[model samples]
Target: MKSPALLGRITAVFRQSGAMDKGKGKVTGVIALTLGGLAVLAVLAFHFPQYLTTPDLRKKYDVAILREIMLVGMVIAGGMALANLIRLRNRWLNGTALALILLAAALGGHRVPVDDFPDNTPYVGLDWFILDLLGSSMIFILIEKLFPLHRDQPVFRPGWQTDFTHFIVNHLLVGLALLIVNFAIHRLFGWMVWPPLQKWVGGLPFFAELFLVILVADLVQYWTHRAYHEIPFLWRFHAVHHSAEYMDWMAGSRLHLFELLTTRVSILGVLYVLGFNQTTTDIYIVIVGFQAVFNHANVRVPIIFAKAPLKWLIVTPDFHHWHHSSEREAIDRNYAAHFAFIDYIFGTAVKSERRFPGKYGVLGDYMPPGFVRQQLFPFTWKG
Candidate 1:
C-alpha cells in the first residue's frame, strides 16, 4: 500500500473509542512505533556524530543519561510490540515497530561510542531534535491533558503528520539556521555593535538585563510579525504558519522555512547588536523557548488572583489564540509575542466579546496541506 494509505489506516485506529483499550493495542502500537523510530534515529546520530550531532548540544547533556534513555526506549517499544503480537492486534504497526528496534540494536544501539570528532564538521542538529522532541512532548502533552482547552483533542489529531514533518525539518536544520543568523549578524550588523553601549547594557542588574533583552527581542518580533500580516509579499510565507486550523502545541511548528530564517535572523540580529550579557541572553532563550510552546499549547491556565492584571502584562494562550483566529475581528490583531501590553498600547489587541476564537487558520484557507506544498506555496500561489 502507498504511504499515505498506510498512515491513514494506522491513524484511524487512534480515532476509535478509548484509545487505551489494552485488547485493541492501537495506542501501544503507536507508542512502540514512535519510541522505536526515535531509537533508530538516535542510533544513527551516535554512529555519525560528525555529520548528525550538534556541537553546542553535545557539551551540555550527559552522554550516559542519553544512552540510558535510548536503552529504556528500546525496551519499552520492544515489550509493547511483543505484547501486541501475542494479542494478535495491530500486527502491521507493531511488527514494523519491532523491526525498527531490532535494526537499532543491530547498529550498536546505545553502545556506539562517540570518539572525538572534528567540531567544525558540517552538521545537522539531530541530537537537539531528539532531546527537544522528547522534552516538549513529555511536558506539554501532560499539561494539555491536565488543562485541555478542547477536552477531546487526541494526541494524534488530523494534520499532525504535516505539523510533525515541519517540526522535524525545523529542528534538524537548527545548525544551519544558527549559522545563518550568526553570519548575518556579524556581517550586516557588526557596525551597529558599539562597545560602550554593549558594556552599559551588560552592566545592568541581572533582572534588568533579562527584562531589557526580552523586551528588545519581542519589540523586533512584534514589528516583524505585524509586517507579515500587513504586507502582501511577506504574508505568503507567513500564511503557512496560519494555515494550521487546529490550536495545539504542535500547531506552532507549522512554519515555512523562509519565515523561520527571516524571523530568526531579524530577532537575533537585534539582540546581537544590543549585546546583552551572555548569562541573561541564555536565560532569555530558555524563557522564550518555553513560552513559545506554552502559548500555542492546547492547555489553559486559570489565574484566580490578579487575572486582569496578568492578562494585560503577558501573553497567554487565550491572548495568542485570538491572534491565530480567522475571525474578522482577529485579523491582523494581537501581534505581540511576549507582552500583551504591546498590543494594547499599539491598538492591535483583539476586543472580542467571547473569550476564545471559534475558528483558526487563514481566512480563505488557500494554503495547501503538505509540508513541501506549503513551502512552495508562497512562490506559486496567485492570491
Candidate 2:
C-alpha cells in the first residue's frame, strides 16, 4: 500500500519537462540512494572509521577533506531527497534519508577522530564506497544528463536497481578483492620478483610507466573480454553484464563476481609481475576507474569527435555503446576496455554505421534480472 500523495508526487516528478517518465524513477531513486548512502557512510566512517578505512588506501592521505565534503554532501543530498519526496510524495522515500542525516549528526558529523587508529582490523571500505559512488555519479550522471545519446532515455532506465546493487557490492568489497588478488599475485608470482626488474621499472619516468601500464592492462583486458564472449562456460557469467537493456554509467558496473574477480586478478597480476611503480599503479587505478564509467556512459560525443583523434585515443561512449548493442554486428565487437587501438588492431572494433545502439542486451535475451539471480545464473543456467 502506497500513499496517493507519494504517487501524485512521483507522477509530477516523472512528468517533468525532460526525458523523465516512469523510466526516470530509477534515475532519481539511484541518485537519492547514492546521496543518502554516502552521507550515512561518511558518518559511520567518522565513528568507526578506523575499521572502515583500509590501511593500503589511507596510507597516503587523510580523510579530513573527505569528511568535510561528506558533511556538505549530506546537507545537499538531504535537500535533494526532500525535493524527490515532494516530487514523488513518498514518505518511505525520505525516511531512510532522514534516518541517515539523524544518525550522521548524532555520530559527530564532520568530527575527526583524534585517537590513535588501529591498523589490523577487518577493512570494510566504507570510505572508498562513499568516494567512488559520489564521484562517479557526480561526473557521469552530469554528463549523461547534459549530452545523452539516447535523448528519450531517462537517467534511471529499467533494471537500474540491479545494476545499483552490483555497484554497491563491488565497491564495499574492495578489501576482499584486494586481499584475494594480492594474495594470488604474491603466491603465484613471488619467485619472479627480481631486484633488477624492479629497478628497471622503478627507473622509468612516471609518464612513460603510466603509458606502459595502460597499454599492458588494455591488452590483457582485450583478450579477457574476448574470452568471455568466445568461451561457452565463461559466457555463462559474462552474459550477466550483457543482459542490461539499458546502457548508462551504471551499466558497466553490472558484472558477475566471478567475472569481476578473474578479470581484475589477471590484469593486476600482469602489472605486478612487470614491476610497475607503486605510484604508477595507483594512478593507473584511478584512470581505469574513470574510463570504465565514462566509456559506458550514455552521453554523446560532439560531432567534432567523429572528425577528431579522440575516438582513436581511448574508448568513448559511442565506441563502447556498439559493444552493448543487441544488433548482430555488435555482439562481440569493441572489446578493449581503456584504449581503442587494440580493437582496431584486432579488427574487433565497431564498424557499424549507427551512432548509438538502438537496443541493448544479450543476443538471445536469456539472462535473468535481479542481483541474486544474476549471480547464481552461471551455476544454474541451461544452454
Candidate 3:
C-alpha cells in the first residue's frame, strides 16, 4: 500500500497532467475549427461567381447572404478564440479580433449591387478574403518573429498606449487619406500626360511591360524611402512609421496621412510617367503592397542559404529588420523595397549571421505614439 504522502503526490501529478491534457485538447479543437472555417470561406469564394450568375439564387438571395456568412464566420472565429483563452493562452486573441473586424467590414461594406459596379467583386469571395485576412496575418506573424522591434518590450509598456493609438489611426483614418491622395494625383497626371504615355508603353508585351512598370515604381520608392531618412522635413512625416517599438503586420500601417500621401504621390507619378496598363498596375500594386508589409514582418527564415546568394536577390526579414534596429551599426542601411540587389548595388545592404535583430524602433530613445499627434507632430514637437 502507498504511504499517505506518496498518495497525495500521485494525486497532484494526475491533476496536473489532466489540466495539460485539457489545454492540449482545446488548442487542437481551436486550430481545427479555424482551419475548417477557412475551408468554408474558400469554397464560398470559388463558387461565388456561379452562385451570383444563377438566375434563381440571384433573384431570391440578396447580398444579405454574404453578410450572414460573414457574421457567422466571425462568431465561429470568436468562439474558437474564447475557447483558447479559457485554456489560459492570450496570444490567439489578436488573430480572433482580426477575423471579427474583417468579417464585420466585409459584411457591412460589400453590399453594393454587382451589376452596377464596374466588376462583380464579391465580398466573401476567397481571393479577397484570403488576401485581406490570411495575407495580413502572415505579415504580422512574420514581423513579430523577425525584426521584433519590441522583443524586450511588454504589451502594456509606457509607449504601448501611443503605439495602440498610432495603430488605430493609421488603419481607420490615414488609409482613407491615402486613397484620396492617389486618386487626386492619378487624375491630375492623367489629364496632362496619360494618353501619350499609354500609347507608347501599351505596345510592349504584358510581362515586359509589367517588369518595366514594377522596376520603375520600385526605383521611385527606393528614392522616396531614402529621402524619408535623409530629408529632415520628410522625416517628420515618416517618423511615425519608425517610432514603432514593436514590429508586426499593423506596424507597417502606422504611418501618418501626410507620409502616406507623399509616398503614394511619388509612386503615382512614376505610374503616370510609365503608363502601365490596368492589369500590370493592379498586379504591381498587389505585389508591392504585400512585399512592403512582408519585408518588415517578424517571421524568421532559416539562415543556411538566407545569408548567401538569396540575400543578393530578394529582401529578407533579416535584411529589413536591420533597417529598423536602433543600433548605430544598423541605421541607414537596406532601403530597397523589392529586390535586395538594389541595396547591394547601392552599398546599403548589411549582412548578419543572427536570425533576428538585437534591438528595434527609432534610434536615440525619443518616440511618441498617438496618431493625431504623429500626423501633426513635426509642426508642433521640437524634437
Candidate 4:
C-alpha cells in the first residue's frame, strides 16, 4: 500500500478503540478491559500453544503461586466486571466482561494445562507476554495515574496503538530475538572467550558479579546509544524510537527491529565473552528489563529516589525523560541505562532546572506517523 493508504488504515485502528480521548476508561473499566483482553489471548494460546509459548517457561504448572495469582485476577476482575455490567447497563463493557467471566468459568482460570517439551523448537514468549502485560499494566499504569508527571497525558494517548503493536511484536517474538542474538554471539565472539577469565569472574560473590555485569553491559549500551545519536546512518534507525512524542511504559518498546537486533547482539557478545555465570546473567536481565520500562514510564518518584544517594545510583524517569526531549540542551545526554554515575563521570550528562521535558520526539518532527511507514522509513528517508 502507498504511504497515504497505510496511514489511513492505521489511523482507522486508532479510532476504533473503547477510549482514545485522553481518558482511562475508569478503574473498574480498566480491570474489565484488561481481563477481557487477556481472556482472548488465553483462548488463542490454548488453541495454538506451540506458537504462543516459550520452550523454557511452561513446565507442568507446578507452582501454586502462579495458579493462585491467575485465579485471583480472574475472580476480582470478573466479579467487578459483572457488577458493573448490571449497574452501568453499558453493553460493550458488560458484554466483554461477561465473556471473560465465561472464559474463566469454562477453561478454569490458572488451571489450564500448558506442559510441552520439544527437543528443538522455535521460541515465542507467549507466557512472558501475558504475564508482563498484566503485571506492567497493573503496576505502572496505576503509578502513572497516581502520580502523573504529565497530568494531561491519558492511558490511551495518540499513537498508543503503534507503541502497543511494538510492545506485542517485541515481546511475543522474544524467542526469535534470542535465537538470532545467541547465534551471532557464539559465531562471532567464540574466540574472545577465555576460560581462565570466565572462571575467575564466576568465582566472585553473586551480588558483586551482578554489579560488575550491570556496569559492563551499561557501558556497552552507553556507547551504542551515543553512536545512534552521533552517527547519521544509525540515527535514522534509532529515530523510530525517538519518534514517540508521548512517553510511557509502551514507548520503551517502540524500537526499530534493526536497532533492537544489532544492540542486543552486540551486548550479548560482550556478556558471553566475559563469561558471567548463568545466574548472574539471568538476574541482570530482570533488573535491566524492569528499569527499561520503569525509567520510561510516566511516573513521579518518591522523595528518596528524587534526591540524594539513590538518585545518583540509578536512572530515574526524570533523568531518561530528558534524553527523549527535543530540547537542544539534551541532544545526546543521559545515555546510561542501569547507572546514573556513568553519565556524571562522563560529560554527556545533562542537569536541567526543569523537573521534566516540556515536549518529546525528534528535533524537527521528522518521523512518519504509522508503524508501516516507520519500518520502511529509515531506508528511504533523505537527510
CA lDDT, every prediction?
0.88, 0.79, 0.61, 0.80
Task: Pull out the clashing pairs in model 4.
Answer: none
Q: Which candidate is the best by lDDT?
A: 1
Question: Could you give candidate 4's per-residue lDDT for residues 1-383 as a string of tens digits?
Answer: 46576556535544553344322234565567577667656655655567777655665344466667666777777777777666664435545666766776686556666555453666578767887898898789888889888887878788888888888888888889888888899999998999999999988998899999999999999999999989999999999999999888889989999999999988878989988998788788888989999889988887687576876778899789989999999889999998888998888878787778888999999898777788899999987
Give RMSD to native, each candidate. Answer: 2.8, 4.3, 11.0, 4.7
The sequence of per-residue lDDT tens digits that candidate 1 reaches over residues 51-140 is 999888898789999999999999999999999998899888898889899999999999999898899999999988988898999899
Residue-level lDDT tens digits of model 2 in 67-111:
778777778767766776666644464555655666676777777
TM-score, prediction 4: 0.88
Name the candidate, 1 or 2, with the larger TM-score value: 1
Candidate 1's TM-score reads 0.93
After the best TM-score superposition of candidate 3, give how far the Cα of residue 136 lies from its true spot, in angstroms: 1.8
Prediction 4 global C-alpha lDDT: 0.80
- What are the per-model numbers of colliding residue pairs? 0, 5, 11, 0
* Higher-scoring candidate on TM-score, 1 or 4: 1
Across 200-284, the per-residue lDDT of candidate 3 in tens digits comes to 8988899999888877887788889999999988887777788776655556667777777778888877687667787788789
Worst 10 residues of 4 by lDDT: 17-26
lDDT of 1 at 152: 77
All candidates' TM-scores?
A: 0.93, 0.87, 0.65, 0.88
Arrange candidates, best lDDT first: 1, 4, 2, 3
Model 1 ranges off by over 4 Å: 1-22, 303-306
